[model samples]
Target: MSRLMRISIPTIRVVPQITPGPPPPTVAEAVERVVAFLAPGNVAVLTGAGVSTDSGIRAYRGVEGRYLNPNFKPMFYNDLIEDSPRGHSFRQRYWARSFIGYPRILATRPNPTHAALATLMRTSHVSQLITQNVDGLHHDALRTKDPELHSRILELHGTLHKVHCRAHHTVLRDEYQMQLALLNPYWAELEESFRRTGNKPRTNPDGDVELEGVSFDDFEVPACPECQREGKVEMVMKPEVVFFGETISQQVKDRSYEVIEQADRLLIIGTTLATYSAFRLAKHALELSRPVLLLNLGPTRADGLPQLEKMVVSSGPVLQEAARQLASSRLSEDANLREVLEGGIVTSIEDV
Candidate 1:
């Protein structure tokens, strides 16, 4: 009943770094293993989409990640910055999917993974957190508990809750929400239909959805209002988060280094260090003699790196149990969460 784009294209798949087969062998007693590594305070936690999986969001890469889906093709930064103009709107294909996806993101709450990290931060168990996620769940989780926790966290890819003008470099201080619904009345109607039919589009880790056969012809994409008034740009507004082909700002890159330098160890939670943006931080942390500990479900780019002190693989938010143990042991004299060097690999006291 509403104006609609009539184009239909077959789905495409973007191949991620394929595995050679087999995930990292698990170290038994995963919780104790994690707590052993977490003994050293000033630990810097690097999180990824995996951490937020319990919150109903899926990770982009993992044993069962979207990146591994042969039918999935992520929208790159180049695609967003240089797609069909007008209704395409720097590719409102991106926005169109986001239009269907953002509601779940806005409705999501921090899960146990968040609570674990928050507990670490509040008790000074860790000094800082550098997250590759742009979901802002970390901020949401720690905001009330420790008002200053947001200050100690560095979002490498930025966040989706804010908007910006690609041409004007202007930040739209508003809930990611406005432009899509406001510009495309028809798209909004389609979204409502999806909800009503319980056929809501499938969403990805980054909050972009898969609108299999949807067209973008009549979708009215919004341009940077300020830029449009100044005779620049044609309907392209971007979420603040870094898209696939985008680069993290140098200032952010520098601050990330500063944050990394503040900690003697890097504990990567729920990430594969797949992208250079996320991998580089772990690489940098290693180059400076910082020991890296990987806690993820499958193989990571950093799996066999010599700089890593240890690695643990699990399908779920394994750290929740570890955090609970750490919290419970805070006052118990029977706490034996320290790592003991036996013959070679680090072992917990319970090993003996």
Candidate 2:
């Protein structure tokens, strides 16, 4: 049995090592200790919305998580494409939110956690980064410097930067222009609604929008490109996101499993793993006797992972300290990039 499994309890204590410095041991100290435990082979990082919180994105399960009238419920892949009112409803809310929210998301920058992981990849410390966030921040972070050293960021959730047709699966980029043109009057109203209510829509872990008091009739939906070519142009639809009662595609599941199989340790940052799809993946990692380290401010469904090592804390400062240490010793070239990841989570250890 692995060390994690050998432990009697579900939890393990993490004691920070104190050392003299301008600042004392921070959350970064904990992350550094965890990263140091990773073996030389494949070190897989399974990240969630927490990593992007510093980048101005809101997490779903914490105090800042979305919980409103037009609140989001998980969707399944099967339900998204099926012709039904529920599916139509799901698609409508998704497109409406995406049409209004994608631009704001695109304007966000990567946080320290992202840069640290990318640096880990460049220095051969990390084998792969498996992320549930679809904001494309990881991809964007990797692009800031050398393309050759760009880390391999496996986006478990589909990316928001592009859209695909449900019927033919023909992918397109920057099609927001077309969506805006079609949305017309409704688009203006939606923007005005947000402004009037001072409501800032948050992007969920599944890459869907979270809102309230909004209906499908308020937005325009586009039609498939392939179907349009065949003179069957109808409202083009894309799954708002993979939802509940739905399974992640076999292809996506298989790839995620493959990464899990190769991972020596599973480091979970900022996710509660509330959904079955993400929770099952963490469970599989635990069953393999892999060490599961969780860093989030709330309780996770997978808190029972065998020999789980966890810190119920915010991600920002913890990741910042980790980046600071790593950059000074091994990633000196990208010191400035690492600081951006440090944000609101910087409270004293006593506060935690």
Best by lDDT: 1
lDDT of 2 by residue, 93-203 (tens): 666666666656665777666766665665555677788787777776664566554435677766666666656465554665465546567675766676577566665
Q: How close is every model to the real structure, measured as TM-score?
A: 0.79, 0.74
Q: Score residue 121 of candidate 1 by CA lDDT.
A: 74
Worst 10 residues of 2 by lDDT: 2-11
Superposed by TM-score, candidate 2 places the C-alpha of residue 89 at a distance from the truth, in angstroms, of 5.1
Kindly give the stretch of ten consecutive residues in candidate 1 with the minimal lDDT sum.
337-346
Q: Report clash pairs, candidate 1.
A: 5-217, 5-218, 77-245, 223-235
Candidate 1 deviant stretches above 4 angstroms: 1-28, 64-66, 83-90, 143-147, 167-176, 226-234, 315-317, 329-352
Residue 301 lDDT in candidate 2: 63
**Model 2 segments beyond 4 Å from truth?**
1-32, 38-41, 63-80, 84-90, 144-151, 189-215, 234-236, 327-330, 333-352
Candidate 2 whole-model C-alpha lDDT, 0 to 1: 0.60
Native-structure RMSD, model 2? 8.2
